[model samples]
Target chain A: MAERRRSEATRQAILDAALELAGEVGYAKLSVEGIAARAGAGKQTIYRWWPSKGAVLLDALLAYTTGPSGRIDDVELPDTGDLSADLKAVLRATVEELNDPRLSAPMRALSTEILADPVLAADYADRLETPVRELKLRRLRRAVDAGEVSADADLDVVVDLLWGPLRTRWLYREGPLTKRYTDRVVDTVLNGIRRW
Target chain B: MAERRRSEATRQAILDAALELAGEVGYAKLSVEGIAARAGAGKQTIYRWWPSKGAVLLDALLAYTTGPSGRIDDVELPDTGDLSADLKAVLRATVEELNDPRLSAPMRALSTEILADPVLAADYADRLETPVRELKLRRLRRAVDAGEVSADADLDVVVDLLWGPLRTRWLYREGPLTKRYTDRVVDTVLNGIRRW
Candidate 1:
């Protein structure tokens, strides 16, 4: 029992060190050696638990964004019976997360890395995108059941429309990602999806 | 006149060489020296025309995509009376451009570089994004004038919605960027924006 507790503590320390170092030097320059030194843990400890620096960074980002839950699967889309309000709430949270100074640099670094490297992109999609996509799909399904959405509406396309603009604005920095913008997006999409 | 023509020819050769090298070795590994060697031009010639390798790559990409016109400002959005059809046609063309083999690598490399480097990002926005965005906004304004779209609709949000899904799908590699998908996105947005 004591050994397990110590192991968990070491893991947390490694993740904390990764977040700190990533923020300080950016992810491209961050190394496992630096993380180990910062955490005061052995290099073997990091290697035994994670396959690469990318993996450690991924975990650290998830932990930082999602908190102690540390699992993206734990993120549930809000469904308050009002589909528009629910979507705006979720998107508002997303805008906040995207704009957070502490998280933006690492997220941008990870996004750039994934785009440049195909192997990492595939791994990231499987581990991170798949679950988050599934969760959003479930919420859309609930909207359909509640008769808020047309039965024939393509939920996949709808989901993409809802989330895509935010990603574009964030990645391209084309415009302000304000709540007014997000709310307008939700209103336009939800109005389109709802049965007249 | 003869000297001016020769200078123009040499500039075109440099851009072509930069494109070819960027495709062959990927953008991160591509160097100006390699480009100069491939083009049979002196490094000084390249530096005289463009300040950085990123500038060369950007010019090469724009030249390739925009064809003989060679100016992004020359590309205009279709303003056919049928907004939905016009939107779909433009998006389908965009899809083809995005999926082209010769263009994809350099484009991805440029995107990664822009996201990682703020100076490059600003330069890219100024050179590429500004003109394209302005063109799209013009089309939306025309739609408003024609009574095809609601006068009060947020044209900025609508433009983002129309273009964002395609970009997100392409950049994220989330799903197939099919013509069917593009048509659906246009239909949904047009429906939402149509004055009732």
Candidate 2:
């Protein structure tokens, strides 16, 4: 029990250091040595647990959003029972999260890294995207039960319509990702997602 | 005039070499030296013309997709007097483009490279995204004039609705990108983009 407790603590420290350093230097300049030094853990310790810098950053992202438990399902979406209001709030919060320098830097790094590595991409989908997507769908499912959304609405399209634009702006820097933007997005897509 | 012609030919050869090498080895392992060697040009020659491998690949992408002139506006979208048919056809063609191994490899490389470099991302937007997006919106605007779409519909949202989901599938590899898939996207979003 003591050994397990110490291991968990070490893991948390590494993830925490990763987030800190990634934010400071951005992902392109992020180094495993820097993470180890910040965490006060050995390089071997980090290597033993994670496969690559991207893997470490991916876990850090998971832990940052969902806590150290690192379960993607643990990430929450608010359901005040109004689908429109709930979606707008969630999207606005995401805009704010992306605006946060500390968080966005690491998130961007992880996203770029995953683009080059197919193995890491699969791990990201399985560990992060798949579960979080299901959870978002769960909230939408609740809305469907409440008769706010069309029962026949394709769940995948609903998810993409609401969230994909956010990703595009984030990745491409196409436009300002603002509350107004997300709000407009929600307002526009609401016509598409909800029962007509 | 002869000197100008020679420079243009050299530039075209370098861009062609970048695409060929990128298709073979992907962007991560691609090097400027290898490209110079393949193009039968000096390393200094490549550096004199293009800033980096990504820049070369970006121009190569522009040329391959839109021909040697590399005018994003010149990349055409069909009208055929039907928004639904035009969009479905375009998306399905995009699906085919993404599936093409020669094209997809370099496109993915450029995308991943842009993620890591802010300057490159900005150039990508200005040189490729902005022009192509405007061209796409031009096609949609014709729909508005024809009374096929509502005048009040937000143009940005309309662009994102059709294109953003495709980007999501492309980047995340979340699902199989297929004609059936693009057709459904057109069918579903048609409700939101067009009138009730």
Q: Which numbered prediction scores highest in DockQ against the true structure?
A: 1
Clash pairs of candidate 1?
none
lDDT of 1 by residue, B1-196 (tens): 9999999889899989988888789878999999999999999999999988988998888788778667877877898787778889999988887888677768877777777778888888887888778989888788777877777677778888889888888887888878998998888776642223
Q: Worst 10-residue stretch by lDDT in candidate 1 chain B?
A: B187-196
**Best model per TM-score:** 1
Tell me how each candidate scores on DockQ against the true complex. Answer: 0.47, 0.41
TM-score of chain A of each: 0.91, 0.93
TM-score of each: 0.94, 0.92
lDDT of 1 by residue, A1-196 (tens): 9999999899999998887788788878989999999999999999999988778888887777667887877788998998889999999998998898677767776777788667778878987778888999999888888887777677788778888888888877878888888999988886642223
lDDT of each: 0.82, 0.85
What is the alpha-carbon lDDT of model 2 when measured against the actual structure?
0.85
lDDT of 2 by residue, A89-173 (tens): 8998899999998998888878877777789999999998989899889987887777877776777777888899998888777
